[model samples]
Target: MAKPPPQPPQEPPQGGFGAPQDPRSGSTDGPSGYGYPPKQPSGQPGYGYPQPQGHAPQTPPPPGAAPGYGYPGPPQPGYGYPGRQPYGQQPYGQQPYGMYPQGTYPGGIPPQGGRSNQRMMIVISAAVAVVLVIAGGVWFANSNDGGKDDVAGTSGGSRGSEDGGGTDPTEGGGERPADADAKAVLQVPYPSSVPVDSMLVPGQWATAKTYAKPSVYSITGYHADTGKKAWKLPLDGQVCASSRHVTADGRTAVVFQERKMSSDSSSEPCNQIAVIDLDAGRKLWQKKLPGDRVYSTGLSLTISGNTVASAWIGGSAGYSITGKELWKSASYRGCRPRGYGGGKALVAVTDCGSGIDNEYKVQKIDPATGRAKWSFAAPKGLKNVNVISTDPVVVAVGAGSVSTTDIMSLDDKGKLRARLSLERPEHGQPKYDPNCRIDTESCVTVAVDKDNLYLPSEEHQGKSQYGDTNEIIAFDLGTGKPKWKSDAGEKRTILPLRMDGDTLIAYRQPTLDSGGQVVGIETGSGKQTVYLRLPNETSESERRLAPGYGTGALYVNGRLFMSRDSIRKNSTYDKELALAFGS
Candidate 1:
């Protein structure tokens, strides 16, 4: 038969986390590529053991014979013996003691081919045994040392010394001393089992728990200064998703929930919104959505005194928090819906049509009354548009061939004051387009501070190189121009951009190798402080995963609550389904 063609080499997923696929072979169900072998059965002979079926007879050695001295007594008939001895000569082919001829056997064994095969075999075995012993010793040493080198390094205020040396106080540490004006804040502990999401009010203490018996999730407010649960209220159905929006005075908090089918069948969706008063834990009101609606992709309830505007996207409509119909529109065929920022004005975006040509429509609406403040068709080439912030300025991002990002300052009348455009390079050069062949363009995700905007770009290279790279660029809000660009060195899916006083807290889903690290980037100097780093041993599949943020506390309230999976093991569908429904 003709030889089969050689198979092409498989490529591992770049930067790691994704589906639980193989690293080397890209196989999801095959053996792990981490170099450890599968478990072996007990009592099975291993390595160099001889098979039992082979035919061989062994003659016992004489007393005091060394371990590998071979057979004693005399050689049997038909076996080669030295000196061509006749039968019965010197007692059955055995050489006479002290009369054995010189050169009869060199090195304690007759030559097989000018060299003693037996001696050669002994030497080879000894060498192999020595090598194995050394290798095992090295492995044992590393195991005892915990497999990491404690190299002398520096972090924060002090020099980090290795196990072998004392830290030098004169060397400048890699990290600056903690700001004397800043206080070391301790994060308050919530229920260890609760799936706490993003914080709505930072530095303030709040407690939330999912009550399975009543199929409702409740949020209890606590004074950040006092650490006491002030009030608790339950929403209407079991909450699959929820968020907390605080009133301007920071005294009142509105806990919003979307009704969904029981955990038994998550596919059965409902269109209802429930609101609870944070101070009294009372059900303020509940509104039935006007048609069969899927749960909202994004929900926000912002209050300006008595005027509260709740923004949600679902049921093919966008509505205010009071269950008042704001604007009814057709649902985007394949894209997820989003609603953001509701003060005097509201901004919403939805997929316009189907196919790859689909575009997003961004509209501004009056919050007091469901009135269209202004509407603008984002550039047709753009795929997604989102409002970054409402106060100071209103910035919206539009992704396109080279992501035409526009930052607009909207006046109270919804009139555009100043507009700034940011264009990402399609290729290293103007004419060479890498995404053209792949039929995909790069996307720019926006992160906003008070007067600075951070735009993260996802650039695609060809197959032979790193497929995607992340870059963050800072744009000045006043001039609407570029400030400084910083490369994140890894592809990261950014979460909500948060401001902790003057510090900006940004969460990113980093590429696989680094695990997921939440970083606090100083918006002033663009320096980053790692707030949290997950354990490195986490599987690549789970490490690349993102979690949903629900009602939680932020930094201002003296606590930060984040939800992430702590453990995952393979299981059957029946087992997983049962666990998901708490059965």
Candidate 2:
């Protein structure tokens, strides 16, 4: 992996109340990378522990633990722990209100649901300028060995993203239907059970009850396509969480939970595992994992076929759909589990090297047996290799330095298909036009659909790297050939949300660069077809938000439920979840 090229913060001010900003530029001075936290004691809360609300501010690891597993080295600094904001400090995907003048944001930010930040680094970098500049025409080839750069990670663990604002079915253009008269079903409001996380299951909406440790946590099944509540399954534990994706058959669910902590004890994470039958709305099997290894957060849970795997501080573990313990790999000798994906294997970091010349290997493990499936070693230059996505594609990035990045894309069979070099002259950050949110960048910013992949093509043009020249590049998924190139719109912007059949659902940033609109584009020709101007987006609290603020959307069943922060009653911030229904 090459060093991660600089990237603009996903949004100005990251989150929390703030004034509107003109943060379209890029910079190299985002959050510094590759600083991991120290290993926590089994009986004490370690770093990244969520402060128990109303309790003390810090917690240690757990108690009476067996010999720990692999190298659970300190967590690198690019991202953060869950259930809490970074607060006052900037993380990888976030930046202050403003920075440089040129921007192209692609990597770093994960798509909305991709929430993990651990992986070995295979970083690489090469540049000779006040800022690194690279030509987009030089197609890269994957190498088994490369030199490593400093500790910056291209798509490390920064968590922040763009908000999408689409309206109801009434605000349309040409012959398209309207976007909205409102952002919600005015007659019904979100239950007090405001969902902290949600997923689309076959014929139903599965939502995890909020994590309120020392109290209660649960998983609820809702009627499909409607707000009607179906079955609520509660658990007895200190904390609770569910996988973002359920089993392939959609009949089983895997959740991680923890035994509660005493008021004066360590605030350990969810260490218990539970597998449920969605159809029966009952627990099929449950067990407490061995040792003191702790799954970082909800992002660590991944499901491939009937097997589910989790990456942890002490090591990584895999489980059968029936909650049977398959294998648990111990963390040791600098080798540890970073994360698992690719639909068939768990990707782990087998090295904890430091500086510009450390050696690294991204190991693929069989989830069922914890056996080494295969490995991709640093060619000799790259280190701090973080492999983010692994299902539809294998997306791994190694850094060359803080300013230059080498991006490697591998197909489903672990074959390197394409490599790209990203950089800017002034060390400006990269600004993606289809401004991908922080979480979904890996497989989304450069989306792969069926036999083809779509990526943004931006050039230095004259001297800057803020993407003055932008186009959509469609490539053969396996061969990485230029099948077609389409104009992304001159001056205007296209922030693709997801692919809908032959069309791409995208949020078209205002042509004047002030407002936002949602439109649909046919992927074959890259032509705009359906359009909807969100009129109700500018609420009392959102009047001054930036382009990607105060918005979110997901296509469920047939309704595109666009979400926004509704101003909370009697509050200083507009922070309640208000959803708009659109066609």
Question: What overall lDDT, based on C-alpha atoms, would model 1 receive against the true structure?
Answer: 0.31
Cα-based lDDT at residue 353, candidate 2: 45
- Model 1 earns a TM-score of 0.42
Top of the candidates by lDDT: 2
* Cα distance off (Å), candidate 1, residue 419: 7.4
Alpha carbon lDDT of residue 76, candidate 2?
37
- For residue 68, model 2's alpha carbon misses the true position, in angstroms, by 23
lDDT score, candidate 1, position 69: 21
Per-candidate Cα RMSD to the true structure, in Å, reads: 30.4, 15.6
lDDT by residue (1-583, candidate 2, tens digit) is 7433223223221111111121333321221122111211111222222111000111332343211111112223344233322111112222210011111111111111111111111111212112222222221222332223211111122111111111111112113344432232211222343222211111112222211101124555544334444567776543333343444334344444464334422345556766665545677778765556453221244555556566544555667666666666544444445445434344544444432234545555555555554555433433234443344444434333221133445544444444443333233233222222211121233444555555554321323333233445554544444555544344433445545455556544333333344556555656554455544443322222222322334433333333331211122232323333333
Cα lDDT over the full model 2:
0.36
Cα lDDT tens digits for candidate 1, 246-311:
333222223223533243213333345554444455555566544443432233333322333333
Candidate 1 weakest lDDT stretch, 10 residues: 574-583
Residue 295 lDDT, candidate 1, scale 0-100: 33
